[model samples]
Target: MSRAFTREVDDAPPPPILERAISSARNLVTPNGARQIEQAMETLDRQIEASGDSEALAALRRELRYWHARHARMEIVEPPEAPTIVTFGTHVTIKRGGEPKHLHIVGEDEADPAVGTIAWTSPLARALEGARPGDVVEFQAGGREEEILVLSVKGASQ
Candidate 1:
């Protein structure tokens, strides 16, 4: 049977860098991995069908199918437009105590603070969003008040 498809948020745009990351992840899945997952699903389906005994197993199958469909839908969704504010997919440069730092604002799935990419939900990102160049933003981090001045904002790109 063909799977039924629906989106939870029809109008929501995907996070740009996140979409790219997801695409990369999907691409990285080897043929063997795909075959393995398919094999597992088929086995599970067969067991569930034969048993006619486990609602939990059937529910698990439904959840797995839902996630698979959601992932596929996300792959096709257009990314959010680059925002003037410090939103996901924005590259922001800032200065703190005369030291310059750069951060790529991305979704939680793509956050990598070691490389300076931070999630938009982070305290620093929250404080920096909507701030223009030269605007100082203060937030508590590591139990101390940290201040950063926005130096620039642009879309994440080469």
Candidate 2:
């Protein structure tokens, strides 16, 4: 090969971007979760308007679409006035291995396990759903079944 014999294609179109995956589970969201989704869409819109790069715009647009879909399918589930059982939009306290863990059952989009929020459709939440105080639930984790004792279930605000 001689000096500079390769041809760079500058006019070629960029690769197509993949769309975000949408969950098939019920799109139940808490009031706060709905607000978070709206905020995300708004932020994305601003970024899309300010972006000058095509690739960046594409990514922003893709994200916006995801948020839009989530917003469209969002079913706001209000917290019960006095939650007596573990359910969506409820705060649950469970005792496992002699340790008490507090978790909020919320929508998938706003779930952050690090902050003690779990998606309603998650295995732990599913296992806890409908469980009342003093009830022991069997939860499968890491290929082992663990017992979780429901200590208390209350409204998210409480």
Candidate 3:
């Protein structure tokens, strides 16, 4: 084939897929959150070592990159010196419609609502940040506004 008919670029493999958005920007994290990031890196490293499948290794590497970036810029913030209200790394129990619900306000990467944790940047958490026990906070959910009564506060998570 002539030079004009052949292309060198076609011989090269496509670039690896990456989730770069996950690795951008630093964020405040709790000690546990920082630990979680470290744990994730460790887990990915082990998986990458043990996996023989190319696809699995690629996925693990992508996860490792995310965790590495997270760990690199993670800023660990201590819990409130004196706990009088809700803040990052603390669990706040609140009641809506007399039904109690507990939410752990944590770093963005540690948020898992199924386990009762929410990111501090979430709307509900933002509204509840400066509130104390017995304080009522108005939160919007599903396009509707509701009131939540703070029942208690759990000490910061380790």
Query: C-alpha displacement of 137 in model 2, angstroms?
Result: 0.5
Residue-by-residue lDDT tens digits, candidate 3, 9-66: 8988867877757624347898888899899888889899999998878888888988
lDDT of 3 at 65: 88
Best by lDDT: 2
Q: Put down candidate 1 lDDT per residue, 44-118, tens digits, no spaces.
A: 667666665456565656645643543343322122355566655667899977899999765444467999977
Ten contiguous residues with the weakest lDDT in model 2: 2-11
Question: Which candidate do you rate higher for TM-score, 2 or 3?
Answer: 2
- Model 3, stretches more than 4 Å misplaced? 1-15, 23-26
Candidate 1 at residue 128, lDDT? 88
Best by TM-score: 2
Q: Model 3: which residue pairs collide?
A: none
TM-score comparison, 1 vs 3, better candidate: 3
Sorted on lDDT, best first, the list reads 2, 3, 1
Models 1 onward score TM values of 0.49, 0.91, 0.81
Residue 81, model 3, lDDT? 50
